[model samples]
Target: MSDHRWSPRSPVAALARFVGVPFDAQTYRNLAYLLLAFPLGIAYFTVVTTGLSTGLGLLVTFAGVPIVLATLVVTLGISSFERRLADHLLDVEVDGDDGGIELAFGSVEEAIGTTKRVLTAPAAWTGLLLVGLKFVYGVVAFTALVTAFAVSATLLAAPALYDAPGVTYTFGPYVVDTLGEAVAGGGLGVLLVLVSLHVTNGVARFGGFLTDALLGGAARSAEAADA
Candidate 1:
């Protein structure tokens, strides 16, 4: 078959191709962004969790829901940061040609106003929802990604590890019982790892769709509303 003919013809194939490609050049850049996403996730998780926790406490201690409101307002800032990061690392353009991010709103007063606007604006709320959704889904992605890597690595290293003297760490229960079992288990693990890559790519695509729904839903609805 021609090189083109051998290329991916389906989503699964595409994901396999993606996994097979060496992390070099533009691919390396994309993978690096994914790697860097963890720290960003940690920062966001801390801020939101802290704000919500403290705010709830204050609301309970005092009265009214001002702390809750404040927490939600702080969330607007977090949402904006998420969008910018997506655009920067994933090259996913989120804004309109003219709507422009409100960089002018740099002061605390302006940020408060922006938060108010974000609260009132359906589009902003939608974007926040998307960010929240992605944040939660990311936990699953990271877990699966790491599990796949670890399982695959351990399985592939079976020959060396299992055959080595005084080595008794089991991989899968069945696979570690004997050398033959190790080979079989390692093969299965490799397959599982390959399958995980497909799942990861699917998750990424779903995340993109979510971004569109939350961020562009307003723009689309606005056009429809106009009509």
Candidate 2:
């Protein structure tokens, strides 16, 4: 009788299949953008909320007019920065529609028109809303990423430290103390670490998709081909 069994060609091949993130470069690039989201989200939320509040609170005062105007101007600058960031990092073409916001350069008239446009454009406010909510996404991503990495690290290191003093491993009610148990736990750890990498990559891709939707406008909608 012949034995029938299936196994991976090699350890590296197994890991590669498990960490099935397409295009390693793209994955890393997405990860880079996701990593920046946390800090950027914080700054965006702080500045925009504070500026809007101050402007509204002081609306009755003579000083309120200029402050409100200045706040809008500052937000226009922030919107420009975000546009550049989305374009460069996500590689999404943000073609504007009627409600789209854009900054023009030329005469003083053009500059004033740009300022007026920024103040009136609905997309500008929409972008601000997106920015304000981005901190929540950042928090969730940061927490998930950190937790996955920590779990992977702890699992991988469990075997080596199992024999060390004051070291204990427990699964439910059973304690892991024997060498056999340690070996089995280590093997499981290796598999989970690969899975964790995939999870991290997935989070990055989701973040990119969301930002693309928020900023890409019609260009993003262009994904659906004509019948």
Top of the candidates by lDDT: 2
Residue-by-residue lDDT tens digits, candidate 2, 1-227: 53323246666666566666544665666666677788888887888778778878898885665566666656555555666665676665454453245567588788677768767654465567677768897778777778876766766776888788876777547677888887887787777766766776777666656655665552344343322
Per-residue lDDT of candidate 1, residues 1-227 (tens digit): 46664556966667657567443244444444455455556665666667667776777566425455555555556555655655665556654221333433578788677556545555545644654665676676677677877888888777667767777858655437577877876787677766665565555545545555666565577667779
**TM-score list, all predictions:** 0.64, 0.71
Global Cα lDDT for candidate 1? 0.59
User: Cα lDDT for residue 200, model 1?
Assistant: 53
Best by TM-score: 2
Segments of candidate 2 deviating more than 4 angstroms: 1-17, 20-23, 96-115, 170-174, 218-227
